[model samples]
Target: MIIGIPQSRAFKWSYRAYVTLFFIYLALPLATVCAFAFNDSVFPSLPWEGFTWDWFFGTEAPYIGVFHESPILRSLVTSGVVAFWVSVLAVFVGTCNAFLFVRHEFRGKAILYVLMLLPLIIPGIILGISILVFSSSVANFLEDATGLWFDGLRPGLILVVLGQFSFITTFATLVISARLQKFDPSLEEAALNLGATHWGAVREVTLPFLYPAMAAAGVVAVLMSFENFNTTLMLVGSDAPLTITMYDRLKLGSTPVLNAVSLLLIVVSALLGLVSLLLQKRKD
Candidate 1:
């Protein structure tokens, strides 16, 4: 039986209706996309065309599936690479920030924390434009002053990673920091008292406690980076990521192949989320 306060029949029915509608709103589009992924029709939308594997496995010209779609495959690889690096760097820096904010007292700590959160408050498009302009300015200045050009300072994958990292790191820091706050200092102290160095104490005690949080943060970073569009669009150079490529393709027209790609992404994202939940449960 329910343990909460009693509710009227009308209240109960309304609440249930609200929840059902909310879920339908969220799931209907995804369900539609998944449905079209198997549709034999060239377009992603319409009356249910007869189901076929052409969108995923066909090898012919107009029916070329995702497996043979060179652009999508290459962009997928590029997105994966960018996500990997963004996750690594974001987790690393976020861990450091967590430690700094939680373990030590410092001047202007509140200000620094607010600054760290500024990126989250900023719109993605604004953030992207800001980074693009700033990087371009810096690159131009360096070339003019030093006569040495740095390609990394230009709009490229590196900038995309950095642009994504700017906000994603904040999320990582928040997750790890919440975990760190719950950790007892005595555990580290006890390790230190037993002749372990500070680093050793952290490695043996604190890091173990933080592993789950870091993993979660890494997953968040990877997802955010992989799906990022505005920032990635601004900083992207010759190579494009999956989201950018999909956007370009959508601009031309909607096809079942894109629905196929979306289906694959949905599957992958669900798997990642499931793994994260399992890890969290195991940790608990």
Candidate 2:
């Protein structure tokens, strides 16, 4: 006896197999890196020299976890602080843009949206260079006129922020736009009819409705800022963010300590997401 297949069923089975292979191809490397991150080896190689958190706790190694180093810890803290602000700034401004684009009708709105999205389409390296040059030019011009030098123009923390914010805001805008498009206009109408002021209605109903999307967009902005390199490279002044510090470490030769750093970063990001999830659960 033969177990048979129809043409359509066979096609579906084959297509499903292809999709499974595609995802495995994409995910296998990340999974491997995560595994290697826990390895006790001196480098990112695989013969399974055995699992160890020695690097994590600085139990044994030349490159004790960066967490034990003051300068590296400083850079990580600086990056965290900057990323947090960028997330807040992006969400605040982007959510407003989304509300305007989705709820308000005005002249040249289509043209305006195209402009808002342009930065996201631009290459990050180019964006970084452009912001550096443009800010420096303005800073120089201002100094020439008034002899007041603004250090923020120098590729540093402020410039890194300004650069990251450019594209991150666009991301936040898109996320909020997606949420806004799905918003129920009738809810707003109903609230207004119930003697709620427009501001009150928006503050209570609209803001709460958009809160989760805002939080997600904010997380994306923070992740982008934390992992940022090109723009940070061009814009960082005398100091470095964690990404830049890691790049510098790699230039001197990479070790499993870098993997330790990456693993710690992954854990921190996961914890942040977990905190958000818990807050959302509480709200629910």
Clashes of each: 0, 4
Candidate 2 achieves a global lDDT of 0.83
Report how far off residue 125 is in candidate 2 (Å).
Answer: 0.6
What is the per-residue lDDT of model 2 for residues 1-284, given as tens digits with 9 covering 90 to 100? Answer: 43675568789899999999999998886677677766777787867888877666663346465557566788888999889889989999999999999989999999999999999789999999999899999999999999998888877889899899999999899887887787788998899999999999999898888888888888878888999988888898777899999899889977677777777777778777775555334432
TM-score of 2: 0.84
lDDT score, candidate 1: 0.92
Task: Give all TM-scores, in the order shown.
Answer: 0.94, 0.84
Residue 125 shift from truth in candidate 1, angstroms: 0.9
Error of 1 at 254 (Å): 3.4
Identify the leading candidate in terms of lDDT.
1
| TM-score computed on alpha carbons, candidate 1 | 0.94
The digit string of per-residue lDDT tens for model 1 on 179-282 reads 89989999999999999999999999999999998998898888889889988988999899999999999999977999999999999998887776665555
